[model samples]
Target chain A: MTINPKAKLEETQDGTVVYNFDPLIVKSHYEIDYVHSYAQDSEFFKALGRQELMGSKCKKCGYTYGTPRGHCMECGSETEWYKLPNEGKIHAFTTCYFGGEAFLNETPFHLVLVEFEGVDSLFMSRIIGVDTEDLYVGMPIRAKFRRNLKLNPTDVYFVPKA
Target chain B: MKNKGQDVYMISGGVTKFTKASPEADFRLRTKKAFDYALNDVGMTLKDIDGSVASYFSDHFQRQLMSGIMAQDYLGLTPKPSKRVEGGGATGGLSFQAGVEEVASGRMNTCVVYGFETMSHVNTWKGNEFIALASDTNFDYPIGGFYTGYYAMMATRHMHEFGTTVEQLAKVSVKNHGNALHNPYAQSPMKITVEDVRKSPMVSYPLTRLDVCAMSDGAAVAVLANEEKAFELCDNPVLIKGIGTGTDTMRLSDRPHGKVILLPNETEADYKNLKYPGVHSFRAGRSAAKEAYQSAGITDPLEELDIVELHDAYTSSEIQTYEDLGLCKYGEGGHFVEEGKADLKGKVAVNPSGGLLACGHPVGATGIMQAVFMFWQLQRTIKKHFKDDALQISNAKRGLIHSHAGTGTYVTATIMEAVK
Candidate 1:
């Protein structure tokens, strides 16, 4: 489907069109001209609609990684990006307390290091849709993409799988 | 006659310009420089190295991946054993230990250890978020615990526990800046005074902007060789006499005990008593140094050592090390620095090469960089200006290098000797 450049634009009184492309897509293309920076979209944000989340892994060393790259951390071999199994266990976690002007969230929220099967390193994410007090070490969980109410429609949060 | 000595010795060493960030020289180029420099410094070639080790989290600093391989390819060394070890600030130090094991265990006669990080290349908030990766991601990040926060907490705790004054911490900044004046490679070479330090903007409670080491970009390399090979390679081969490392619980709350003091409005005495309170993390540095001392056959580090290069990642960390490394008695670190005992011309010259405080701590390169400074001092590659001929500590017969990971969690120490 073609995105109409004029359709997303707002007509001004002077007839100069002001386009309203999604901030996320706008960040990836032209310079924002004058807005704060943003993070690149990841697989963690891709699975919110109900499919599985996958990351690229090195074929030679079997080291799984987030966001596909051309090489591996181990074995120094050129790597091709591939989909990884989403099921992982909670390795470590923490909760935040202090708030600053830039910090968008309130009070305390859970952040976790999720370790996938057969991978040595952990994947970091916010463990939503679960009670914070109930979490523990080695908890078995799966990945779920959750729609973020506060962010744009495309924004997603990684919730824990039961 | 059979000569008996400890298992580890540095057969090669390398370095790159200490900068905030290297655009043309990323982690890969810097690693290659250090690697080639180390090999050539030891009169060897890339083909002579048998294994490779490095310190890097992810290539988040430069937006690259597989830093280890990227470095290995830079050397054109293929199919050799290569691995990456990530331990935050102690990255370089831990990689040295790994290299030592590789050579000591007879797995390889020559191993290359490299630490490369372009910490300044990333955005400030993103960099903060990346460093927070060391903390409990879920709990600490959401709670606003940053790398500065963790070190700040340590500074606050140290102040409370030992009656350590902010002036004492300022002494660390002043002394390091004074020493940097003589060092050509130091990132911040201007002289700073205690008054200057006190007036600097406070970053986290007791730690002023001057108190913390800047994020630096550089690479350091070391080549470990067996005893016989070492003898043939260099005139002054620094022996890696002993190597030891340990990890404390990563979580700040999980750490045995200590509360984070937020309000600086409290009295000075309140801060002192709360800072270090029986905290034993410095023991990690002492333990590593003790083993290094024992292996090098030294009885008194105070009188016997010629030079010392300590991992002063922060002013507070360097002060803590004075107690941990047994350079002074317990709770006497502040007094020692206040009296100029650890000054380059004092009883024992500490960080004559200006240390990480001024030279910049580029994560993995820090430990090896410490070793390189010691090697240069031992070889007289870096000139030492002495006022009195009699006061001069001549020949640098023995040198010590110490480095630690986050909040003193991991430590690596090595002893080197100058043989004419």
Candidate 2:
């Protein structure tokens, strides 16, 4: 006679560990990695590895976006790559003592919005090699590219122009 | 926003106590509790709610997709048409507007808007990362663009251009936290002085730890209905007079400089030389407020509105919104706060419920919390809710509620009046 298949069961019938019991709370873990193309804006990150700062210029509005956009903000129009100057002036800045998990260990860092000459908008990056007290708006700053690029925005930062 | 549609009224509202972690109940149960309390307040039941709009900032915190559906099921609101809204910090405000539209459009006679958030799901640091995801993931997030960092930079520019001082920013913390002392549901109520705020540990420059709102877990509910049903449902009905929504580019730097959008109260010469909506100002907030006022038939907000419940994610932004909402001219917010213009006794009481700063910002729940507070304030029921008359805006007739997201991306300005 053929025996019926049996379903397997855990040795312990207890469920996942309950962190709390008043309302029955349990731990739920989640994490994931994302792989997505930068698409039209890929050129900006590539230019950083080549020691070049690239932005986008709207073909219709002639608005040069320093932050590099795929389209213009004033008038919705496709944009093209436009090379940016290495040196710019600080438009706004802050010294952060607290940050996200990715940058928490690197606390007390300066973030600046750099405005290039003739460029209508600003670009943001970290400012190293200067004290918080010394950083000021209108301070001349220049971009510094990493020799080893991680293909990330942090690959390019700013330093006070000597 | 005209009166072409049926007039909508906020019948009743309720909220759960705000806390860092709610061990007594999960997100869905918290919402149900708020819903039950709201229904009880008006002597109604779930059967009275025609539909619902759910608001929560992120699904990552709850770790549950279709959280709104789960909440609907738990609240016994299933099989009724329902939807969820996610708009960073503005989710609650957007959800309120969504429910109002339901009744206004003749689609439903009554609609319930509920919002909740469990920010304590992950560790504080991981939660910061989750909040940071609201920024452009590739451009801004990659450079460690924390929300605090963005506001700090903006606050710094405001200081540079307008001579705004850290002391002025500190006073905002003192004002908001002090106001929270009267709010039972407030998270970080303190009788803090400017010195205490200045001494608080720094999160970002010019913004001390006390200047920032702590993330928390909470839920709030607002029941809305048409004019006919409003009177039948409640004794003191508050009309939803006007609604406006505005948005800016996701990237802060992409914002283009333009002429100042004139509010009904201001003249062009008042800001002829100023470069509008710089990092120092929120252009989207101005746009939203302007539209709200236009629809509400308001000529001047500071003079007409009795109170304002605005998003104060940071102390500095509270000052910025004062200017955006036409309470004061641009570059005058710092002085306005220093002069005690935002106090309960001021021309128009601001954040009588302690706002996001002291009320505890639970992402999606914050805006609805503001609405709940406003509804109580307008209904002259503040003493009923707080058990004390210490926080009521005396003779409050009209008020405004502002919800903002990101640096200045999405903002909604909604005006409400106590309809006689």
Q: Give the winner by TM-score.
A: 2
Off by over 4 Å in 2: A1-6, A10-26, B2-4
On DockQ, the leading prediction is: 2
Give the Å error, residue B402, model 2: 0.5
User: What's the count of clashing pairs in each model shown?
Assistant: 24, 0
DockQ of each: 0.03, 0.76
- What's the distance in Å from true for residue A22, model 1? 31
TM-score of 2: 0.97
The collision pairs in model 2 are none
Q: How much of the real interface does each model capture, measured as fnat?
A: 0.01, 0.79
Instruction: Give the per-residue lDDT of model 1 (tens digit) for A1-162.
Output: 988766766656764333333321111121234442223333333443545454556778776664333566446787654565667765545443322223424435455545566654445555666665566556777665444422221232356665
Candidate 1 error regions (>4 Å): A1-162, B1-6, B257-281, B384-393
Chain A TM-scores, all candidates? 0.57, 0.89
